[model samples]
Target chain A: MVHVGANPGRSGHRLSAQAARIVFDTRQGLAELFGVSDSRQIVFTSNATAGLNIALHGMLGPRDHVVTTSMEHNSVMRPLRHLARERGVRITVVAADREGRVDPAAIREALEPKTRLVAINHGSNVVGCIQPIAQIKEAIGKVPLLVDAAQTAGSYPISIERDGIDLLAFSGHKSLLGPAGTGGLYVRPELDLPPLVRGGTGSRSESDQQPDFRPDKYESGTLNTCGIAGLGAGVRFILERGVETIHNHEMNLLDVFLERLRRIEGVVLYGPSSTEARLPTVSLNVEGKSPSQVGGLLDKRHDIMVRVGLHCAPDAHRTIGTFPDGTVRFSAGALNTTDEMEQAVAAVDEIARS
Target chain B: MSSGKHVVLAFDSIHDVIKAEKIIVRHGIWCDLIPTPRELSSDCGMSIECRTDDLPDLESLRENGALEWRDIHRPE
Candidate 1:
């Protein structure tokens, strides 16, 4: 923030150009991360919810049907809900198994003649089950697939072309290790979704209408350049470290945490039984204590930080049969070590006993 | 080499201009980023200033989908 603070794309000055370069590099970095050939297909947003909102609202119309899984967060749920009530859009939420796994064939069965979009989360923020995106895409045939990668973007290996993902929304804060308020959406080159909002794009000053372009079409206002710079650096670090290496490290941490938690009495774990099919996120509840109680104790006494309750995905909690009361969710990242996981497990054990 | 002749390539956005500039430099061609001339276009952003002789290379870049230019200006 100290230097290169000029508003990007607004002027021709060196500092402004520098700021624009920062934004460009971020787009390129995200493109590289997601295996997008053209970086222009990626557009910056305030968060993943903003990106999802754009992809959903821009593409879907009245009488259009959307098929989404039960493991989706409110980011996907709320927009679909609004479209259903306001725009007369139809929604069919395919139920996932108790472990939060959605069958690919079920997605095919759920398809309708009016189905315009199939929205699903790449990973569950609450239960951590990773979806089979390619299989789901194959099942849906020609319909467009929108994957919300808010929980899996940086942590998992995702290639838009290889995975057959038409639209992907991701969060920079969760697994990308970027600052808050930095996220993006990737629009497949073949797809044309209108902008959520339109204004000055620093280009086409002569035209009052919104410029029909890749990024400038979606990104209307001034971007969070400072946040994007940090996001670019974070993506660079991930690239250097290798996403596979980071994934293995996180899974190892999850394995150790899971083993330790299983040994503790009165603790019931949720999500996939194995670590191979899930992220490092884990949800559990003590036999008798409420999630809030255990979460509060973990914070106050043990100084261990973990999110508690619905996590904004009541449907996910409902899928795992932890709705209303919710679960104590623990999410580990690349920086977390096995030692820290052990400490967290010990804290959970104590909380379980209490 | 002092050839007074120059070709101006204006793009729809600064992103394309910067991308084209990088590609031109990578191809070992000479180019300068200057403010888009008002006569060429109303875009207040930047544009590419290159030698007229490098038009062939810019054409090849555009043909390969590597560059996108809205308009070209050549001195009479």
Candidate 2:
């Protein structure tokens, strides 16, 4: 940030060019991380919600039907609801199993002749169940698939091409290890979705109209070059260590944590039983204790913090029968050690017992 | 003034200009990212300046799909 604080692509000066280089490197780095062939296909956004908004609002029109699931966060739900109210768009929400697993056949059955897009949450933020994205692609033939990878971008293995994902929205802060306000959307090169915002891209200065291009089409105004620089370094760190290695490490921690929690008398766990089918996030509740109460105790007494309540996905909370009140989610990261997992589990056990 | 000694390549996007600059420099050719010359039509604000001696190399890079440019100009 100190090095490249200048506005990228705004001028032909050395500092501007340096800032542009940082943005370009970050773009290339993200493309590499997501297994995208063309880096230009991805455009920076403020966060995953913004990316999802672009994909949702830009592509869907009045009377267009979209197929989604109950496992989606408000990032997908709120936008679709707005589209339905404002543009008269139709939506079909496929229900996931109690474990937050969406069936591919259910998704295929939801598709209509006028279905314009199929949007799925790649991983449920509430339950941590990883959706069967590639299999869903085979089910819904030519309809474009938009995968919201907000919770799984760097934590899970995702290849846009190999998975047949038409669009991907990811958050850099969660698993990509970048700072907040850094995220992006990847549009398949063949799909020409219109820009959500347009003004100055530092290109086509002679023309008053917005330029028709890969990135500049979606990316308008000055970008968060400083955040992108950090994102680049974060993605670089992930690439150097390898995603599979990180995933395996987190899974190991999760295994230890879940095993200990399962042995507790009053604790009830949510999501898949196997580690392979989920991210490192675990949701649970203790008998006779509200989620917030447990969360507060864990914070003030044990010095261990966890997210409690609905987690912004009311439908997911409803699916798991934890609605109105929610579950206390213990999210494990790559840096979390097995010893830390044991300590956390011990803390939870103590809380449940009391 | 038409400077026959140097060639300026204009591109459609800053991405292409930066990419072409990297490929050109990596090929042992000297180039600088300059503002697009007034005489050339370009969609981007930046262009690359290189010696005329490297023109053949730039052409080869384009043929090999390493570089893409909208116009070539020699400004006086």
Candidate 3:
């Protein structure tokens, strides 16, 4: 707010200095969280969707073959579909199992000789199953791997070096505890992912050409400096708390919720039964009640909050046989406690019975 | 304009010039971005101005591909 209320913009030391600090702190913080070697590789975007768009538009083009999955959100699916319609690019979608798990080997078989990129979600926002990128990377060979970490970023310990993730798009609002409209991607220094939008970057005021740099090349126009300030603080908070500890807290809550939830009569759960292979996000449907009804009852009567409906991954619902109706999403976050989990279980059990 | 023999590096684009400013400033070098003198060229872009003694350092920057310059101009 200090940055915004103070009238920050180009041609001033206050704004310029704040920009520099935002660059330093946010980069350093995200780099530390993701285990990136250099902070320069991080480029802020409006959201993970925008970052994914930049990656897709910048890397793939006509005649290039891309491999993705049926479990992708519209963010990835819509862009690829647009490219398919307009650019004549070829896309092969690897199908996930009934459990919403993609066989790592099947992904390799789907890889064509001309496959330019393999874009996958680190974890499904709808089904809540974590994709095994480490295993999938071993099969991907030299193809670039783009992991959408919107669901896993601040909640999971993801190492680009260890996981062999080539490009990672993350949302600051989700797990990083940052403001909305604040997110970014970490591009490998050797790789050049071109800019999706081009204009003045405040640096290259002379020529109309975009600057050919890591960040400025991709990040053109005036940035969300205030949101970036909040994002920087958010990342710092994650670092102080330690990602593993946060993950443990969320996982423990999941353990209790799952143990009680599976025993409830008429309660049907989707995705992995155990939380070990996914985020703390769980999806389920009660016996007789619709997703909306359950969600309404939870919110109105129990004062519980959750994301419901297709969760923006329709294909994922189809994979798990929940299309059209969707499921109630009980996602545990950084601040959610075990007490809340018990209450959530009891409420769901009550709703299932009533 | 200023009565001194200064080193002004001409760049192809504004992005290069801004990057040059950031790189130069980070290395403890004091430089100012100013409009190209009207007598110098018709490009109508900005240049990074420094002391004539900074030539070796500037040349080194150019050698390493960090800075790209179209030409070096010394106002008479």
Among these predictions, the greatest lDDT belongs to 2
What RMSD does model 3 have? 4.3
Query: lDDT of model 1 at residue A176?
Result: 95
The interface RMSD for candidate 3 is 6.6
Better of 1 and 2 by DockQ: 2
The number of the candidate with the highest TM-score is 2
**Model 2 C-alpha lDDT per residue in residues A59-146, reported as the tens digit of each score:** 8998999999999999999999999999999999999999999999999999999999999999999989999899999999899999
The alpha-carbon lDDT assigned to residue A99 of candidate 1 equals 91
The candidate with the higher lDDT, 1 or 3, is: 1
- Flag clash pairs in model 1: none
Residue A194 of candidate 2: its Cα lDDT?
86
Let me know the TM-score candidate 2 reaches against the reference structure: 0.98
Error of 2 at A24 (Å): 0.6
How would the candidate models be sorted by DockQ, starting from the highest? Answer: 2, 1, 3
Clashing pairs in model 2?
B1-B76, B2-B76, B3-B75
Tens digits of per-residue lDDT, candidate 3, A1-354, equal 454433222343444544554555677788889998766688889999999998988788887889999889998989999988888889999999887888889989999888889999889998678899999999988899999999999998899977888999999899999899999988888887778899866554556777776566777777787887888888888899999999898889999999999899999998887777778889999988999999999999999988889988999999999989999998998898889899999999899989
Sort by lDDT, best first: what order? 2, 1, 3
TM-score of chain A of 2: 0.99
Per-candidate TM-scores read 0.96, 0.98, 0.84
**Model 1: per-residue Cα lDDT at residue A264:** 95
Q: What is the C-alpha lDDT profile of model 3 across B1-76, one tens digit per residue?
A: 3745686776644444555677888767778777666554523246668877777887788799766667777755
Q: Count the backbone clashes (under 3 Å) in each candidate.
A: 0, 3, 2
